[model samples]
Target: MNSTSKGDRLEDAFYHYLLDQQDRGELIFGAYPPENCRIYRKKAYYCREREADVEFDVVLELYRKGRDTPHLYVIFECKNHEASISEVYVNDFSSKIGRIFPHAVKGVMVVTSRLQAGAEKVARNARMGIVKYDEQGLEIIADRRGSCFEHSFVRSQIFRSANSAKSLKFSAYHDGEYFSSIDRFLGSLEPELVDGIRPENGGGSLPVPYLSIEQIKAAAGKILKFADYESGAVDLVKVCQSLSIDLQFADRAVLDADGVAILGSANFGRKAIEINSHSRETRERFTIAHEIGHFCLNHERYLRSETIIERDLFVTREKDGSFNYERLEYQANAFSAELLLPDAVFLKKTAHFRRDLEMRDRGHGYIFVDDQPGNSATYDELLSRLSTHFEVSKQAIEVKLKKSKMLTDQRKRNEASPISRVFAGLISSRKS
Candidate 1:
């Protein structure tokens, strides 16, 4: 392969491999806990010596325990071709990582090709670890004090290859299937963390602002009007980009979806919102919108303030059975609903609701035309059609309808309180 292609593949391989490691309970480095680190790819860091910036293949920021504060920095540089890693390149890379990061930094060199005769020695002297990628997976050739370099180098410590090498005791994953191993690994890790830490009761916690039905509708209205979405649907990817939120798809085994917003220095680079590639197209879009909601609503700042947020998971619940993240989750859910199912578009699309006399109840009688007769059947059909038209799940459409008062029942759906009614009316007038 060409140099550019090989370099790109190596970067991708290491970034993904490290993410799986983080997902698993494996220690990323001595100080960088698996659960507390954030990984960035192709990130540029400014070098004091050269007065110019140099980009690393991957930069992993390890956060302090129980806080969002970043504690340590680790950088990885990858080479794919057989070109030998020279001592000069190792020194230069080490210098850049050290100069760029204010905290203690560890430099890692990962290469598909073998290191030169003296390269490992040079890297080790510089406190850098060298990893060589092979058909069997990754092998760490140079040991360093700060990292789990020795553990990763051994045959037992290597990531397992999909075809074979499954017998290795410490191997958490199959080599080819890097992402699939994440869920199994994460499930085990969560119990350990939860057992060690007490659940936050949330009494003194700041209440997450509620996104009322009309407020969410207004948010959606603003987006559609700004984007000029006279059409039924909006290009969410484009919208996210316009808002400076990075939307990405990652094939993850453990997580259906997740995202993060970087609050650190810009030199470290912009953060991204990741959707699960394994999810269905509709699900992917919804997840992206959900994460976008988190970003727009400043949910990450709240999450990072107290404790670390796990992938595809929330923090432990309060004693009263409310989640520490319940309000944040609700806000994001509301945002996603409004963004995907604008009141104008959603109402227009489902305007032709046919009366289902089969139910024999007035309130529950409405069902979309061509939908089946029974509640489950009819709702399913409505969900399917709305999901298709809006490119969201039936559940999402249902939430928007019920919240906006379009779908209602006396018992299941509460009447909007006076305060809520006033808030909704105010939001509607402002939007108009």
Candidate 2:
């Protein structure tokens, strides 16, 4: 599409996003109720200094009850650019909003990409908020009545400055503070709202204890027994039903995420899991099982909001090869692996497939994987059979095998050469 079309699309998306928040009673601006909040697109305001009407991409007007005039005005300047937005855009937006509405007005510069060097400083100096809004990143994984976990998560990601705009679902920055969603940004504008908002259960600041493989297996065993599951593949749908958790699917971009687990709480009565619709049935099944794992492990105590499980969350190691036991994501992943592939059933299936494929080696104690000029085909066949039987991804099956110590990966060993090990040690030392 053309640049103008793209810009317009972004404006529309943002406008609707605000409208949705307003409808949900989340767009709080200085105690203004949802009915008193007015959102407009392509709104024009008269500028006395310029003696002409200045147009805005999107506008939010908050009025008191029974009053016609709005007490607060929020102007959004949308910039949909392929490159990073420069300080010039922020300066221009600040100038226009300053000239048009001098009092009780807030201006926000929203872009599709990151800000150029010095752009954020210019925005902060001008007392204007900056929002990096990628349409693909607008998916909602989790939310709570008054939780700040999402805000904390977004702030951590923003401070890292490692993830691109597409990697973040939503982020807002104002006066050195980061917000996770637009509603939170709006609420921050008012001191009263800021004081009123409290983090639910300390806002996911507590560390999750590391769960051993045996503990995860026990949890999965109870779930399987509860579902009366004695089958090849664990039926996630039946399991969710038995637990009274709702399962849903949505057609979203793959970059958005794999799935989200919304845990039941006093504020939010029902538990639900939303999986991104995908063509790969195995992938979808794995996502479902992963969310179910969260529920079975009672992660709601730590995760107070909706927990978005991305592909990267499945990784349990840091770059230096240290385990991240503080994150519930690792625990959930372990539970998912056990729930999908039970020990007894998985071991029996693996042995049967290995025998059927004649993967036995007198010299090696375990099956070798990705070994060239050897039994690579046999290992692949074993993975395929196990993956098919469990209705999970081959990668998942491979991880399970390594965890079970039933296979040896040559590729992993090759990657961990002497030089790499030295570098990894140096990196770990530096971190320490």
Candidate 3:
């Protein structure tokens, strides 16, 4: 193949590989506990020393939801080329990892090419696992190139090509997919430095009075207005418009087709927020509220750079508002969920309807299935009636509950027990 054509094909394949993994919503981390954590790729990782030697596009830290996880890290490496791996290469990568995230407990690597001599052996010897992307596909996966998103990459730790975006969309928004499980997982994450997140100034912060779930929701409610007809897609569109951050209600051909993001122009006019239109009666509303969290707290910092990392995946950040992939992803998700499902709403919902169903630390027994504001008080009913009304999903609601310590658990568990996804495959996903 011509050099240009070869590069183009490689690029196409590279993205396709990412998208396919994205759709499946997971990665094959390894043979041990952290082995099964799900991974969501962001812009990539970079750490500049002084002025340059600045590391270029490295794979973001892999992700995995630990059970009652106080904090667990999913470390990973990515190399997109067709070459064999080896002891020298693995050792070099390992040494680099040691320097970067010194305290990290574990890590994984993605060699999207042939494994070099002694590479697999070295990885195995190091007690790490290797995933190879070659001419062939996963022997266990039926779809092979078609793809499936578990967001918990432990299934088959290997790949050859990417799949349709639809599969990932399914993993992201569906009620029963990885997100729901993530809700459960989040429900279990314990705070590191547990204490009141109060700031020095008491004039009420931009989004809330404090760094908390209740405060975030309260902040969102103050900023947004909801309409009764805001169901499916229309309501989400209206919410986005009401906020003034900028968004459109575009349709998608998926299960959680709440809305599709237009990618560029990030959130209408601003370059930070991506303009996504969702249609889920409950989910779309929650998404709108969630995006509001981003606008209120993160937009400006992000717009300063063309490469906005999705979700605060990394827990680390720089002064100029740049951060690692995992931190950004986690922050964005937490911010959104906090705003959509605040404690005030939860309290009221339980107050009015506490008599009807059984409430537990993780979730309520009510199977709220409303396409709009009426039925399924699970989240909407609770939030709508509270001082700060915002629509959130039961999963998100549960997550909010755990984060606020409404429920108590302080350990992160790497969930390896396979379960069906909340929603299997769809495009426009936010990592499972």
Candidate 4:
């Protein structure tokens, strides 16, 4: 697309994104209800100082209780460029907004890429907000009935103030706190504008309940019962149908993430989960189940825009030993595991396989498998059997086996071979 068209697309996408947030009663820019908030595109406001109409890319007007006219205006300027935005653009926007609305107005510069050096400083000096609207690696397979595409704001960054760090990896920030999504950061600002609209604990970290494996498994079991699921492999599509969630597969080029869950809103009609169509069947199944876990756990209250990346699916702890979004990812993964492979059914199948294979435990309270050539065949056989029956990947089956304490891997033990032992003795002798 041409540069102008690209810019228009970005502006249109952002406009709808704001509208969706308003429909969901989660729009934080105005802190007003949907009925009281009005959004317009390419709107022109007459400036008394300039003696002409000043056009803005997008505008959001907020009305107070029982008021006829809007009491506050939020002006948005969108820029789509291949290069970073410079201080010149920021200064011009700052000047325009300043001359037009002296007070009770907020100017936000929305760009498609990063800001140039010193641009942030200029924006901060102007008391303006910066939002990097990135749609990298996003492909729209289907639109919302061929009108507006179902885009996600999770990849975008919203800086209420330009004083924060300019890291593309983490974009949402307000008052030194980092948020995972734009909705989260916006919701935290002016939380009192609407009662009980802000997230609990009043920060970026989502308050994910601490759930044990048993608890997660029990929850998954209940969901299975709810779906009347009695089969070898869980049919996640049917579960979504029962729950009234829309499930779709789109051609996603993004490698870092496999799925995205756009929390249901009135504008969007219903909750939707989109999986990367290019992923393997097993991976797709896992992604669907993971999203279902989020829905079943009532994470919708806190999750406005969620992109399920590989790290979010597996990593449970941060480097500093704290759990933020990591905790939620962990819970979802545990739930997915149990939902795919129920304890009773899995254990019974395992026992049958063990009896048929005459596999003996190696005194580790479970069957031990290692890289040893003798055990390789048996290990592969067991994994293949379970993977085929469960319709999940062998790697997933192996992890499930280890977690269940039904198997042990001695591959690390092989590193301490006789040659290593001899070397260790030699080193000790030399020290002596």
Question: Which candidate should be chosen as best, given TM-score against the real structure?
Answer: 4
In the range 233-328, model 4's lDDT, one tens digit per residue, is: 888888888888888877645532112332111101247777765346877777788888877776654444355654454343222333345455
Weakest 10 consecutive residues, lDDT, candidate 3?
418-427
lDDT tens string, model 2, 1-432? 999998998899888878877777877634688998899999999989888999999999988788899888988999887666788888888888988887999898877666766787788788787776654442332343443233445544333255322234457777666666566677766656554553323343233455665777799899999999986988888998999888877776433321232221111136877676566686566567667877788766644333333433334433332322224455565566668778888888888888888877666657876557556777777879988898877766776676667767766444443212322232222221
Put down candidate 3 lDDT per residue, 219-255, tens digits, no spaces: 5555443433321222445555655545544453321
lDDT of 3: 0.36
Instruction: Tell me the TM-score of model 3.
Output: 0.33
Cα shift from native, residue 258, model 1 (Å) = 15
Off by over 4 Å in 2: 65-67, 134-160, 163-166, 196-215, 235-253, 256-284, 294-314, 317-328, 351-385, 391-399, 405-432
Query: Considering lDDT, which of the candidate structures 1 and 3 is the better prediction for this target?
Result: 1
User: How much lDDT does candidate 1 score?
Assistant: 0.49
RMSD of each: 16.6, 6.8, 20.0, 9.9
Better of 1 and 4 by TM-score: 4
Report the poorest 10 consecutive residues by lDDT, candidate 4: 142-151
* lDDT: the better of candidates 2 and 3: 2
Alpha-carbon runs more than 4 Å astray in model 4 = 21-37, 46-53, 62-71, 81-83, 99-104, 132-206, 252-269, 317-323, 362-365, 412-432
Error of 4 at 1 (Å): 1.8
Give each model a TM-score: 0.39, 0.71, 0.33, 0.72
Stretches of candidate 3 off by over 4 Å are 1-218, 225-235, 249-288, 304-327, 356-391, 400-432
